[model samples]
Target: MVTVLIVDDHPSFRTSARRVLEDAGYQVIGEAHDGQSALAAARVLRPAVILLDVQLPDLDGFEVALQLTADEDAPAVVLTSSREGNEFGGLVAASRARGFLPKDEVSGPALAALLR
Candidate 1:
């Protein structure tokens, strides 16, 4: 099973995402409520992928993705947001994230497909 770290400021979304991913056969190692914690968790947990929220309290997902993907062997990042990807105005396409998934479309299959 692929290991994943979920990053989002909303507790409800994190909980829901954990359940959805776990049901879809993904191993959820940890969750972070902010970008700082997400970065710290990534360093320690070193999950295979990170489901990062686009609008974080500390640093935006793009900033976090840049730092995360800077390292060799960095985990794949899949950006997520309640808003549509086009709303970001090419920011999502330009990010180091592997891909973008809208919040409502966050399924195990969708995430796995993005990683592939």
Candidate 2:
């Protein structure tokens, strides 16, 4: 099973995502509400994937993705936003994130496809 870390500012989203991913057979190793904590948790937990939110309190998801991907054994970062994918344009393609997922479309199958 793939281990996952969920990073979002909203507690409800985090809780809901944990359920969805877990239900899909992914192991939810940890969660973070902001970019700083996300970074900290990623280091400690070392999950296989990171479901990262774009509009983080401390830093944006793109920024975080870049930082994480800089590491030699970086987890696969999948960027998520409440906004549509078109709004981000080339930002997602430019970042080191495996792909971008609209928050509403974040499901286990969708996330697994992105990792592929």
Candidate 3:
């Protein structure tokens, strides 16, 4: 099973993401509300993938992605957010994320497919 870490501030989104990923056969290893905690969790858990929200309160997702990807054992990072348009897409490209998933477009099966 693929291990995953979810980092998002909104309670509802976080809960929904966990349920969706878990139902799709991925192991929901950890959840973090801010970039700081996400980094800590990543270090401890070493998940196979990280679903990160771009508008995190503590730190932006791009910065988190940079740090995480810089790590020797970095996991694949998929940036997710409600924001849509070229601006966000440009940032995702610049950050070198494995992929960017629009919050509205993500479902259990879609997320599972992205992981594969």
Best by lDDT: 1
Give RMSD to native, each candidate.
Answer: 0.6, 0.8, 1.5
lDDT of 1 at 15: 96
TM-score for all predictions?
Answer: 0.98, 0.97, 0.91
Q: Which digits, one per residue and each the tens of the lDDT, describe model 3 over residues 1-116?
A: 98999999998998888888788788899999999999999999999999999898989889999998996668989889897735664778888668888887766677767667
Per-residue lDDT of 17-90 in model 2, one digit per residue for the tens? 99999999999999999999998999899999999998998897788889988888899999998999889889
Model 3's TM-score against the true structure: 0.91
**Best-to-worst ranking by TM-score:** 1, 2, 3
Q: What is the C-alpha lDDT of each candidate?
A: 0.94, 0.92, 0.85
lDDT, candidate 1, 1-116, per-residue tens: 89999999999999999999999999999999999999999999999999999899989779999998898899999999999999999898888889999998999999989988
Off by over 4 Å in 2: none
